[model samples]
Target: MIRSERNPAGDPSGPTHERVFRALRTRIMHGEIIPGQAMTIRGIALEFNVSMTPAREAVRRLTAEGALSMSKTGR
Candidate 1:
């Protein structure tokens, strides 16, 4: 679920955290990011050019929806 590449529309553009998160959620719901990949707050924040708090919030929501795993470490 890396966002270093262009979007599905094939357009190179600006920050896409919401877009990235949406895409990842779709893949994750479809089991693409997977349990093994283990998404992290900092990593996603870095990937999407956002702050950790926002990334944390997004991941927290996903965990709540059972999309991603909740780590006690909460990294």
Candidate 2:
């Protein structure tokens, strides 16, 4: 989801990675993310308007938390 500048969810007042992580985590827990859905770090970065670093970190964290499952192909 593209965070809009006028949206409160896009507060832009904290660490980018944390914000991205929280947003994604909430989605996962709330069943917004479907089973077997796949996305790339690059796609995350682009969608969230963040740099690769933050997006990678967020994905890594979610993977570690079991909120996201990584495939052998690293999807």
Candidate 3:
């Protein structure tokens, strides 16, 4: 199961996209995801037990934040 630290704002229930974002951000920050490791929207969705939309949004947010990058083929 995917586990994450509690929200610092004391809000137990947050948006799915935000939760996914925070979880992914935490993983990135902690070096859990090795540099250049392969990742996919479907994989993230399955791992986080979320739909493709939330996983894509998390990836988009992370990419915008420079936490991840996409190639010409969107890898």
Candidate 4:
């Protein structure tokens, strides 16, 4: 289980991108998103009710951390 001491929605301690990152990371780690599943920045932004920039940042961070892989086609 992913534990957070702060309430992401109400906490002002972290940036919006960090909140999105933690949420997505937890979902991925918990098997909420299956392997080889299709995901997009637009989809993530919509799901998290955040802007594309934060969504992109979260995706980029996840990719860099080896939690996700991006193909040449940017899938």
- TM-score of each candidate? 0.62, 0.79, 0.79, 0.79
**Candidate-wise lDDT, in order:** 0.65, 0.83, 0.82, 0.81
1-75, model 4: which lDDT tens digit per residue? Answer: 533333445667587788889998999999998788888888998997777888889899999998888777666
Query: Comparing 1 and 3 by TM-score, which wins?
Result: 3
Looking at model 3, which ten-residue stretch has the lowest summed lDDT? 2-11
Two-way lDDT contest, 1 vs 3, winner: 3
**Per-residue C-alpha lDDT of model 1 across residues 1-75, encoded as one tens digit per residue:** 453433424436433445556766888878767676766788887876666765776676677787777767764
lDDT per residue as tens, model 2, 26-55: 998899988799988899889988778888
For model 1, the local distance difference test gives: 0.65
**Local error of candidate 1 at residue 56 (angstroms):** 0.8
Return the lDDT, model 3, position 24: 90
- What ranges in model 3 sit over 4 Å off? 1-11
Clashing residue pairs in candidate 1, if any?
A: none
lDDT of 2 at 8: 31
1 or 4: which has the higher lDDT? Answer: 4
What lDDT is reached at residue 30 by model 3?
Answer: 100
Pairs in clash, predicted candidate 4: none
